[model samples]
Target chain A: MSRRLAEAFAPGSVAAQVAAADWRAATRVAGELLVASGRTTPAYTEDIIQMLEELGPYQVIAPGIALLHARPSEAVLTTGLSLAVLEKPVEFGSKANDPVRLVFGLAAQHHDSHIEVLAETANKLSSPRFVNSLLTIHSESDFQRLLSDS
Target chain B: MKILAVCGAGVGTSVLLKMNAEKALRTLDLEAEVVAMNLANALEVQDAQVILTTPDLVAKLEGTRSEVIAIEGIFDLNEIGEKLEKALG
Candidate 1:
């Protein structure tokens, strides 16, 4: 586990049932969570938006989760992750996976520096238990428990 | 068998899929080199037997020579592994 990743997904990173009408709003909320935590600059958020505009909305990797991110760049302050669950599910143009409920926004400083963190997240996400926890967690402490236990 | 897990960005989504691919391979007791590549570099996968990716990105490989298997439930290891077994067979 990267120390940077630990800080990024730390206690305060989880937001419960944010109101987002669409992918743009959901992504904005997730990016704002990271920005509020000082993990990424405003430029990082804009970069994510720009990437989506340039490349379509293909970030929804799983059925309910979308891993929102841009490439490693100067816009990032530190490698980190922030997750937001939406009150209403939003579509991100995924054919197999739509109405994504969770957005995990990530920012890395280097291209491959986040492989370990990505791998860890991938491992945890495979579990129905953990993913279910993300959907049900109601408080910051609940989020923290899921983060550490998973 | 040479497999390629592809996504929009080489480093982000591809990396996660690569890890899952590797785990699926291990669980199935199979041996293969799984390389993660971005859409731009997807054309370089001529030597690859199966290309695993999402549905949106699969269209980008419509004319490609390699076999494209669009993964359903992209985050589920069991589903991905089952698809891998079918593809490998």
Candidate 2:
């Protein structure tokens, strides 16, 4: 996963200390990362937002973090990710974790044998040290470094 | 024995949970087939003994033979392991 997933969290995939009035804005910004990276189309970003509206903030899988994504569709061209850290956390109406600080936008395909990719990404985000640094991270290199060290 | 890890999107979180479940099961020194499936298709997998998921998604499966384990923090492996320990104890 270290070498294979490096492209997912590539240099331009990070946005730090962004200011958004609410979670919707926050999510839109985060989802757009996939579009900018050419991993997914804008429609996929809309799918992510629509998923939130239809299913609630179920993507807020952990405290202070939300992993945004939808099912595989024509909107997704490849497996990639975009990450965003907020200046001020916004509530996504999650019962367990209300305010989210870190948002990971995911676009995964069925092929490339990406089972390891999902596992590694989930493990890295859940690790205590990585979560701590992920909140304070200001650069893509730092984010890459943590994933690399893991 | 079989354990199923489920999420709204079968491709992402469930796959991750499948790996995490493997780790937790290893720690418990228990052997079981672990499967990851999306919520929409999970109900069809009736052979699973236990189903793991987030609280909100658990509500989708109200009455079922399989034991449903819902976690507050879906990403926390410690919480996941502890809950599984208590349930499978």
Candidate 3:
């Protein structure tokens, strides 16, 4: 079965609070999406935050993009992928690539499964068209449709 | 041969690039071990004949002795394979 990616947006949701300079805020927002979408539990949110805190800032990835993820057992309730487009980009280490407006969060039951999905999503994101479409998407439905089409 | 693919977190783009590289190597009649890792662990992973990553990361990894291919776009398997062929040869 194809795992359908979901979107979660709430007023004052973490996704909306991310600033171009706040990496921690972006991670929190990503965690909120996981919890709201039923992909994770409330208790696991702290674990996600911890991973970001320990591995975040510089020397992780570039600045503009934040690859927020956790070990399979720490928080993933299922196998799925999700995306969040920040109204403003945030930083996550990579100085050359900071101020990221797009946050792609991944969760899987195991290592192999996580890698498989990551490979597919990465291939898709490499496409300029796909990246452009993702940036312009305005709603959860739009995001869902993009995943479905892929 | 073993090729270690690297990116920011060893979770997103790097893993994806590993998948693409595996597929491309098969078509090229090349047998290889493709593994993904965070940039921090690249030096730790011995036996990597080649290191594949984005241009931004590649720039940071300059002056390395290992063969390095800076993929402008990791999603494009064709481009990735072409680059691999050049590096592998």
Q: Which ten residues in a row have the lowest lDDT in candidate 3 chain B?
A: B56-65
Query: How large is the C-alpha RMSD of every model relative to the true structure?
Result: 2.8, 2.3, 5.3
Of candidate 2 chain A, the 10-residue stretch with the lowest lDDT total is A111-120
* lDDT (tens digit, per residue) of candidate 3 on A17-113: 2343476666666667777766766555576567556544332232344556665575667655545678776556564566687775565556566
**What residue runs in model 3 are displaced by over 4 Å at the alpha carbon?**
A1-21, A42-65, A148-150, B6-11, B23-29, B37-88
Ranking according to TM-score, highest score first = 2, 1, 3
- Of the true interface contacts, each candidate retains a share of 0.52, 0.54, 0.22
Grade the docking of candidate 3: acceptable
Q: Give the clashing residue pairs of candidate 1, or none.
A: none
* Tens-digit lDDT string for candidate 2 (B3-89): 888888777667767777778878988788888878878888778889998777888766766899986766566888888888777
Can you give the DockQ of every candidate in the order shown? Answer: 0.50, 0.53, 0.24
What stretches of model 2 exceed 4 Å from their correct place?
A145-150
Error of 1 at B47 (Å): 3.0
Residue-by-residue lDDT tens digits, candidate 1, A47-150: 88887777767788778888998877777887778889888899987777787998998877776777788877877777888888789877667777667665
Q: Would you list the rank order by lDDT, best first?
A: 1, 2, 3
Model 2 pairs in collision = none
Clashes of each: 0, 0, 11
